[model samples]
Target: MPVRRFYKLYLSPSRKYVKTLKNLLGFVPGNLSLYRLAFRHKSVAQSVKKGVKNSNERLEFLGDAVLGSVVAEVLFKLYPYKDEGFLTELRSKIVNRANLNQLARKLGFEKLIEYDNRMISATRQGSLLGDAFEALVGAVYLDKGYDFTKNFLINHIIKSHIDIHTLEQTETNFKSKLIEWCQRHGKDIIFEHIPNQEGESTKLFTIVVNVDGEVMGLGKEFSKKHAEKLAAEKACEALGI
Candidate 1:
C-alpha cells in the first residue's frame, strides 16, 4: 500500500495538516498527526478522550533528546580532534534556550504554534517557541525517521542558520566568567533571590549578586536561573571582568 494512503486510513482528520507540514518540513510527512500534535502546547491541550490528554510536552521531551544526540553526532564528526569539554561547550551554545528561541523565530515556527492566549500572552510567546521547535523535531523524527530529521537539522538548520565561527567567539557563560574573576581576586560570590509578595500568576524574582560582602549587581527576571545569569552579567560588567 502507498504510504500516504496507509496514513490516511488511520488518520483521516490530519489531512489538512499535510500541506502546512510539507511547507515547514520541506517534505510530506508520512504521519500527519505527529506534526499536528507537535504544535499543540500543553496550555491549549484538549482532552482527546476522557482520561487521555494530548499535548506537545511528551514530544518536546523526546525531541530534546533526539536533537541533543544528533547535534552531538554532528559536532563529533565536524570536530574530530576537539576534546570532550570543547564539544560539550559548543553543543550547549548551539542548543541553549536563547539560541533555540532565535532559531525558532528565524524559521517562522512561532506563527504555526497553537497556544492558549490567556496562558501565554504575545509578549511572553518568545519563551515557548524553543519548546515548540523541539516538539517539531520530535514530530519530524517520528514521522520521517531519524536520518531525514538529522539531514533536515544539518543541511537546513545548521548550514543556513548557525555560524559556528561566530558562536565560538561569543561568550555566553557570563556566570562562569564572573566566578573565575571572583576566584582570581580572592572574593566571595553569592546570589540571593528576593522574596516576591505579588499575587500575580507569574512570579518575578529579583537576584542580587554579592562580591566580598558587598552588593555588586542586581537583576530581575521571571525565573531564578535567568535572574542569576542577568546578575552575573551585570557583575561582570561592574567588575570589568
Candidate 2:
C-alpha cells in the first residue's frame, strides 16, 4: 500500500473518519478536506474569506451540473427512442430534492453532515442531506477526475440504490407539490406569464414562479400547462421543495 493511503486508512488522526467515508463511498478520498467541507452546512460554517462561508453551497452548484450531465447521458443511452420531454421529466424525478434526500439518507449521509440544529428548521433539514450529497459528488469529481466520478455514481450509487424503472413509472406533479409546500408554510405563491418578446414563437409560453414576492423560477414551453409545470419544478428546486 502507498504511504499516504496507508496512513489515511490506519495511522492518520482522522483514520476513523477516513474509514467511515471509505465504507460509505467505496474509496478513500484523495483530499480529505474537500470531503469534510462537502458536509459542512452554512448553519454551522464559519466564514473563511470575504463574506464567504466555507459551506457546501458552491460545491452543490458544481455537483448539480456534473450530476445532471452524467444522468442525462445515461438516460439518453438508456432510452434511445424516448422523446425529449420524457427524458427531461425522468431526469428531474431522479435528481429532485426529495429523491436526493431519500437517497442520501439511505447512504448514511445524515451521520456525516455538520449543521446547527437550532438554526435550521425541520423542513429545511430535508434540503440539507440532498445538498450534502451533491457537495460530496463535487468533492469526488475534483479529487478523482470526471471518469472516476461518473463510474462511481453509475456503478456504486445508481445501480446499487436507485430504481430507475420505478422512478420512470412514478408521476410527480410539481405544481401541486409546490403549492402544497407553500400552503403548509403559509407562504404566498404566484405564477406569472410573461409577454412574448419580438421574434419569439407565438406558440411558446413563458411562465415564472414567485414565492413571497421573490422570483423563484422560470420556464418556457410550447404548452401553457407544461410551462407551468416546468416553472413549478424549477421553483421547487429553488426552494428545495
Q: Which candidate comes out best when scored by TM-score?
A: 2
TM-score to native of every candidate shown: 0.67, 0.80
**Model 2: colliding residue pairs:** none
lDDT assessment of candidate 1? 0.83
Per-residue error (Å), model 1, residue 148:
1.6
In order, the Cα lDDT scores of the candidates are 0.83, 0.94
Q: Mind sharing the TM-score for model 1?
A: 0.67
Residues 114-150, model 1: lDDT tens digits: 8888887564577588888899899999887899999
lDDT of 2 by residue, 58-129 (tens): 999999999999999999999999999999989988998889999999999999999999998888888799
Give residue 121's error in model 2 in angstroms.
1.3
